[model samples]
Target: MRWLPVLPAETGEEFSREGQPGDAPAGEGLLSEGACDEHSVRADVEAAAGAGIDRRVYFEVFGCQMNKLDAELMLGVLNENGYQLTDHPSSAGVILYNTCAIREQAENRFFSKLGHLKKLKGERPDLVIGVLGCGAQNHQHDIFRRYPHVGIVCGPGEFLRLPQLIDEARSQGQVAALDLDTPVRFERKENLGPRPRHAFVSVMRGCDMACTYCVVPRTRGPEVSRPVNEIIEEATVLAASGVKEITLLGQTVNSYGKRLAPGRRIGLQHVLYGLNQIDGLERIHFITSHPRFMNPDLIEAIGSLEKVCEYLHLPVQSGSDTVLRRMLRSYTMDHYRKVIDQCREQVPGIALATDLIVGFCGETDEEFAETVKLVEEVRFNGAYIFKYSERPGTSAAADLQDDVPEEVKRERNQVLLGIQKRISLEANSESIGQETEVLVESLSKKDKTRWSGRNRKHQIVVFPSQGDEDLVGDLVTVKVTEVTPVVLVGERPGKGS
Candidate 1:
């Protein structure tokens, strides 16, 4: 097992003292006053080993579905090594946070929760705390300095080394495996024990695009596509274990095979073709596609594949060419429109979703208006709108001035959100009285009598449970009875229609 060199421990002191008098604010200081004393650390580990310490881990995931899959794989590894999972942090002997560094808000929320864990760590000195994923890669040793109680810091690429890192942290102090240079490997085991109906399979890692307002390149490194055979084999295992649907994950998913070797340079369409052949898998989906790579071959595959859903999540940061140039998106408004036109032409009634960032650096009123016009023209089935948050280590933060005032950014965000809400409501309203196939996922959080699932277009459909029949994982026909901006309320077709 590979381990990063441990940070030298302070001599002759307990490892629990987190902060000292007149130290820099909560997350800035070096090693705490009494942390990582070699003899004491060994004693703690030996004592815990002698007592047969509880191996319950509380794992919390943040950010995208990609992070969730990483946590799932890591948990599977831990389970193989005699560790069990727990929902409550207070009851667990180990706590892991799989964090994201996509937006500033996510980072802030993670720090707030990490602060809360300080009290928990103080109470249980033997408890092991770990920080994983993108945030760990971005913050590295700085996380250890800020929160000395953090036992391990492993990046996304180094997740397979987590068990070894945890043991090292217990014996030494503050072990980090933040090596983004290494390629990420996915295990073929079934990891989604809780959600067996659906799973996320990461087909590729990292991004080669130099979008100015993004941090993915810095956190995840350059593009590296997993071999096509590996993905197929993983999906096959998932299907055999009762996963009905699989969503391929990547930073730029549609650009999967661009970095592979020439002989094995099969694109996402080829992978989708292979997965579609799996007997037990019912649905196939890929997310967060880039316009530059959504080639005709992929579009044709989506239209023709029996298992691929008629849904696309293509993010267009801005609709103005000037803003696109500034953001280094490498696509123009006209080019994006052409791609949308192609999808609509190829697959009729396709549900479209997008991500839009408002009030980017130096965004003029006219540019914002162009974005509004594009939204009106496109009328996406769903949209996720956000005010652009300047991320450190990106070109926008280093060079471009965040000239858009906070209130203006907020106003632009609201304007786009209101437009999308109206459009979404109208789109869903049209679905009323239409019968669609839904893959039941689970019981509704609002009411136990109802079950929640998604249609082929990726629209949420909620229907009542009939008698004692367990509808989970079943594809049932639901007649749309009512509609909201976000969900479609429905019932079994014969009973309601």
Candidate 2:
């Protein structure tokens, strides 16, 4: 398996809160996308260290990395405030639901889940439920008005006030709050659960990207990065507690610090460089870099930092500049090409992944062909090709017409996916018969005899343990013997041919 920089040890922690780790609100987070030395890192240490409130708390996360990291910190906040955690929603004193709103479909699912909770409240009238994260921020009173059972609503920034909100929720059955409006960089909460070998450290919150089709700016407020010192300290603590990998999260990570004036800022590249120095940190990674923010220094850091993985998930939502202009992406196709060229030059064997929308509002066949051409040229390792789904309150929803027919959109999506399948097959085939360093993550879901991990390029690798009981969490070299569209099959070095 690849390396995860084994951490010292810590207590347990939650997965993420609904408010995005990015600057976006909860409902607007779907657009993106641990265990550790379990027990050795005991869970909930952060709770024991802070405020001392110990009521039962639970979290249900939706959306992407930002939300997950929010959930992680929320646990510390709840524990410090004296809220204990319980897995069952029926038994909890106060139920917290972290929400996401990236696409129409994910939002639809959010409501469906909310419907399930309505019946629970009927059974136990005192069982208070609060909606937090993106959903609370995006549709604040709607959740409360639509479902009276949802007693409290708060955005990510408002999580600190949850204890008081719960008390207030008891009387009105609705408490609306959000932490998004203030200057960010609050104190890091203590560990709430056992430390995993990996962790998510949020560096920034919100977005200023007025992308025509996005709700981030409206729901999440504006871009605000955490001070560098706080980030470094939190990461150091994670390293000391046995976190082997740390993923720095933000809305558009590359744009970090641009919103803040000079002397008060350190960019994402600087953060990556800073975190590289932390003891026990074996690997570092960051996400959602905008094309406009892809700087040379960040490119060079990726190539130079051995601990940094060679995987870049750059989103080129559409290939046509006309469509991009309408979408307010702020970078052209040629500019993206230059960034990709720089990435390949800097990080050898870099896995290039991206996001693409197949059928956006008013997208033409010709424009889509341009996107196809772009895909052929880039030959991405993987592409999240999606059909445009309108989101209420977004700029595009107000200004643009939903012109593409559903079937035509579907056809275009299939064509793009076909192109991606070809590219993915070719990209994966290149690794065959070649040896790659892998980090074992988990046992295969389909077969326990096999182990599942990923390479530095972020490609999934599944291989047999080869009877070396000492296989999990260790870095080992393996030769790619087979390939699939999504996974790479390999055999350990020195194992039978």
Candidate 3:
């Protein structure tokens, strides 16, 4: 839940979108002139640590897996710079909220939380409050004006300047580090918080596709893929440190290595091949793929690779071609079906998941019915169904009318959820009596006696632990016995009747 920010690059002058020196806003002071020294910021933080000041930071992250990885990396940097993470915001010297601007619900939740923090800030005047990620990038200086208690506002790209921004915000009145021009790197030497059995490795950042209702391209900037060598090295380090599974994080993960040189342009398939060679890694996964980029090579890699799990989370926002055109999703229903058909053909029994936005600008009931029909035909393992919420600055919000009534949107959302629920239940029922491999993650939250893990298909399988042995990272064979729409109840192979 806690997150960290990036260290600022050593640059005395701030640059505008045009890459020219820009004047700081009058009231906002924007990190003070010439205060972007990374070394000085580190020294100040180190001195603060030496002085026994509370370097505890309470970080609450909102949004997707990419944001989670961002938080992890920033936490590593903060940890390196003499900051400690605390769960309790009141006890911490700093409180940071890594926000999401994608959904209206997420934004509302953040503002509500920020409102609650006003009393806390009033009590502790020195409590350095910061906002990071998409919301920070989208709102920027406006956040400071609205929430005067906020000392720092950093975008996703400018995380490298986090430590420096925090230091500057403490010394100066207010500081803003909103720069989306620079490519955000995902390398960190140290691991923050607990060293879990699984981790997320961000292979790429941002998105090139301009979906009308989405805010990723605006919030995260353009797509930038990390070098193959760098990704392999990061995964290697993670495997060596006891990580068994790693989900490659990106906006559109399948489009990795598109911008790299011809010699180094190996794409995501090659990245999988490299990770498959790592000694300790048990499983590999990537998420939120684009249907357009689900090429044959990537599909072959998923089928062929030993470590790569057989699961795909491809989001088909809508089923209607007209809606798809308006949404600017590029691919049509037929193309999406073809992609799914190819995936199933290549990797038999591959569990498939997707994202669905029920109501968009001018979605019709007939279009909604087509989505329901697609769900019935595909029968995905799971689907993240959401009602469309207009995002400001997006093309849909600017150009199109949010004509779909809220009641209609809600009805359509429930309809899809119902269909997917039945499909999921049926799929899980089919798995009963079959043996599957599960990487034990932790003890079940509801039942202390049982252990929980995910199979290669990314299905949640729970089995009773042989209390004598620890199975946190071990791959155990489980015989599926019972199932629900969302979970699978299984037991150790021979033990299950």
RMSD of each: 11.2, 6.5, 10.3
Question: Which of the two candidates, 1 or 2, achieves a greater lDDT against the reference?
Answer: 1
lDDT of 2 by residue, 140-233 (tens): 7588778888888888777767778888888776778876776544446443322255567777888878887677777678878787778889
Whichever of 2 and 3 has more TM-score, that candidate is: 3
Model 1: CA > 4 A from native? 1-54, 263-265
Off by over 4 Å in 2: 1-54, 185-195, 259-265, 466-471, 495-497
Model 3: CA > 4 A from native? 1-53, 193-195, 262-265, 495-497
**Candidate numbers sorted by lDDT from highest down:** 1, 3, 2
Each model's total of backbone clashes: 0, 63, 8
- Return the number of clashes found in candidate 2: 63
lDDT of each: 0.74, 0.68, 0.73
Question: What TM-score would candidate 2 get against the native?
Answer: 0.86
Q: Write one digit per residue (lDDT tens) for candidate 1, span 351-414.
A: 8877677888999999999999999999988766657777777788899998899899878877
Every model's TM-score: 0.88, 0.86, 0.88
